[model samples]
Target: MAKLYFRYGLGKSAQLCQVAYNYFEQRNMEIAVINAKDNETIRSRIVVDGKNVLVREPNFDLKPGVSLYEKIYLRDSDVGLKCILVDNAEYLKEEQAEDLFYISKMLDIPVIAYGNRLIDEKKTSLGVCRLMALADDIEKIDMSMPSKRATLDFNYGAMNCSKTAQLLTKDQSLIDEGFKTCIIKPKLDRDELYIASRIGLRKKADIILDLDDNIYGQAEYLYRDRINHILVDEAQFLTPRQIEQLRRIVNDYNMPISCYGLKSDFLSNLFPGSQRLLEISDNIYKMNTVCSCGCGANFNVRKDRFDNYVTEGEQVCIDQGDNYDSECALCFMEHVMKIDTASRKRVRKK
Candidate 1:
């Protein structure tokens, strides 16, 4: 039997698994990628390494201790799958992980599981740590590195991003134009200006201040019938789901929503919230800035107190001494990543 492996990562675990699946398939290995979610609403196809990777909804009964991939393998006279993958395995209960382990032993096929360290607290045994305890081998992946950074900031202006100051100015202008604008910021963003929000991250933002952070709980502070526009600051700290919720509010309330945030993190990875904004925002605008290399830049980098580049750590450290700046993709790849300039692909302006 192929060994069972648990793959855990920060921020990019899902993408990591997808990349692995693609690699295996390219090598002429048969693989069954299963979606563990009971609803599995996300079936969108993704283009990876220039090839199509479809998100397949699992056809098996996905409940704990009930996985039976062997039957499906036998019934289909197709390429024999050497391995099976459980994407979003954190959603599975402990018993479900057990089931997969048992199935792997019985079928003599590897079962690879992927999940992030973050977990929904409401769950019973779906915690990622629990599943890790049951795996034959464990692999943890994180692109973040410790800072040799002089300053750690999410300065988009340096990266050709629309400036936060510009966003605020626009909001003030709209407010002056007789628009009822509500401005809010995520607690994660450490701007000189601050706003209070819920203890945890929220998807929706149309509410007033309250001890509780939900719309209904904060109803005393908001006039649902009176809001004319919504402006969000430090929006990069929000969850992707929250970005969609803001969109729904914009339509349902018949108001416009403007969000300003870093499109990607210091590691040049997309923030979940910013990515959602890119996907569904009505209008996307860039406040461009110039890089030190004299090219227009749009990527952020992290440096340590000693001014050395730091490449290890989590994607976010809300208040660290590290420094951040923007650079062109080419320069960042060359200077920070040490990629050969000749091998670097020219990054075109958006």
Candidate 2:
């Protein structure tokens, strides 16, 4: 069965050239290489550690237009084309992507597309997004780390692990370095326009993300203002879709985004937004804190006014009756689960 494949990454052109080479190696395998960027020739380099190991130049160019499907159909009919390979596919229009989808589905010809996932570093490539949506299969080519590009970073930790402090420090450092920065917080976290740390440091956020806010659109607006970096606090309050929007902003605008939040709720269950960030973020950092037992804290523990461990409650609570603390896994099991410890008894259920 013919399949439409969308392969994206930083240096996907090299993979496209390799695919073309492999196809040429097979006898009687004819393929058409199209450059969606209208380049007369497609050049690809296998770079390792900032050095080019091999270079592949495929001499073929097909200017994309309304007649693209007709041209491919005619070629297949005349020469029995086995596959169609497209480079710079991020430049493809939505209509062109749909045309390729139909070409592959109707003619039983495999279409493999390679392109950067994003264009400007702040906006997702709509053409690539469309192809990805329509592709039968998707792949990512992880080229050697290219030059330092903007990245999406998720810095997670238990309560009082200084995640917000780190976010604030990073944002301020970037500002001190002459880079414009933006601070954003989910409205679900608090009504305050500023993000404050337990240690008495706070900064007014430039943007407050409502539940239905479009973070990517916000990033585009920030890009126009020359905002170089974005720091997000209480990111766990963001929805999973918002995390994706943050990722798209990083890729599209080439802006760095650092998100600070708890990875899990007090119940030790993953938060949807935090889980999404873990899945897609380019970098993940654990902000370390110590439990009262002097061990590394890995869980957030909620408590009542009397400091009894809270067993269950709503996932989100801010400035509420309960207080929160960080605990090591063993302490969590001992204090909350009342297991393997004679020192403290679990609070009786009401």
For model 1, state the Cα shift of residue 262 in Å.
Answer: 0.6
Candidate 2 residues 98-158, lDDT tens each?
6676566556688999876566555556676567545555565675665588889888888
Q: Count the backbone clashes (under 3 Å) in each candidate.
A: 26, 9
Sliding window of 10 residues with minimal summed lDDT for model 1: 148-157
Look at candidate 1 and tell me the lDDT of residue 125: 33
RMSD of each: 15.7, 16.3
Indicate the worst ten consecutive residues by lDDT in candidate 2: 341-350
Question: Candidate 2: which stretches are off by over 4 Å?
Answer: 1-146, 341-350
Give lDDT for model 2.
Answer: 0.75
